[model samples]
Target: MTASLELPDRLAAYLQRSGVALAVSVCEGDAPLMFVNDAFTKLTGYTEDEVKGRNCRFLQGEGTSEEQRQPLHDFVHGLGEDSGRFPILNYRKDGSEFLNYVFMSRIRDSSDAVRYIIASQFDMTNAMQRSKIRQNDETLRTVLSDVEQMGREYGLAMMSSAQQLADSVAMMARLSLRDTR
Candidate 1:
């Protein structure tokens, strides 16, 4: 990425103030990082000065499998146009793990050539946890249904026996009354 190519001042200012974690990489060479927003620093703990001219792969670690990163690699190398979305397990500068949902899109020049790739990353840890919680909730519902069914069966058996006993007592009382008469 050459420092000579710069974003328009108005667009740059807007991106700098945006709340989204944004990164722009040049399509040339290894797709080096050319720009990053403040939100990107907040998410990855890296300043623009430290990441400039470097590939954004620094945030990836052991948690990011080769299969998950291959699409990104292909996109960076201009080998794939369909590589747009990625769910990556990335590491922060403090060594903590975060699930990042990244959306990458290309910027083309007037000649229809690729110029830059803009990526927006969102933290997906909470969404993943919510999905697990929904699964657990479904399991709990199944268990509660089983417990209720068992209780109903037991209660019905007890009620049937009690009714039978009452009928027997009524029959014996009538027999004794008839004999006395």
Candidate 2:
């Protein structure tokens, strides 16, 4: 993307201050990064100076699944018109892992030729982990309920057995008393 086709001053300032991470790359070969907002730098742990000429794929690491990469590849190749959104395993500069929700779209010139690719990345690691924790909590609750039910059943069975034993003792006492009389 040409630096001349700049975002409006007000809008650029707004994006730079946005809480969401945003990045822009040229649409040409390799799609080298052209701009990255402060949030992007914070999220990826890379300054714009370090990433300006590199493709964003540097964020991907060994844990990044191939399934997630395919859709991104297709989107960048113009195979799909809709913006692509996918969760990818990404590693920060410190080798820490995070779940990144990547959303990518193409920007076009007035003549409809693609000019740039703008991508936004949102960290969803906490949200995903919370969801898993909720599921585990539900499972634990179900297991506890089952255990409680079993305990109740066992208690009832024990009570019934004790009552039967008491009745038998009473019958034997009456029989002995009759025999003595």
Best by TM-score: 1
**TM-score of every model versus the real structure:** 0.67, 0.67
Off by over 4 Å in 2: 1-8, 129-181
Model 1 is weakest, by summed lDDT over 10 consecutive residues, at 158-167
**Model 1: residue 77 alpha-carbon error in angstroms:** 1.4
> What shift in Å separates residue 63 of candidate 1 from its native position after superposition?
1.5
Model 1 Cα lDDT, one tens digit per residue, 85-137? 77888998899998887767666544556667777676777765878657534
Q: What are the clash counts of all predictions, listed in order? A: 0, 0
- Highest lDDT: give the candidate number: 1
Candidate 1 local Cα displacement, residue 110, angstroms: 1.1
Candidate 2 lDDT over 1-181, as tens digits, reads 4554454453346447645577877778988887788989998898889999788889999999999888888877788863567689999988999898776767655455665677767677776577865753464354334334433543432122212222222222222223333
TM-score of candidate 2 against the unseen true structure = 0.67
Weakest 10 consecutive residues of candidate 2 by summed lDDT: 158-167
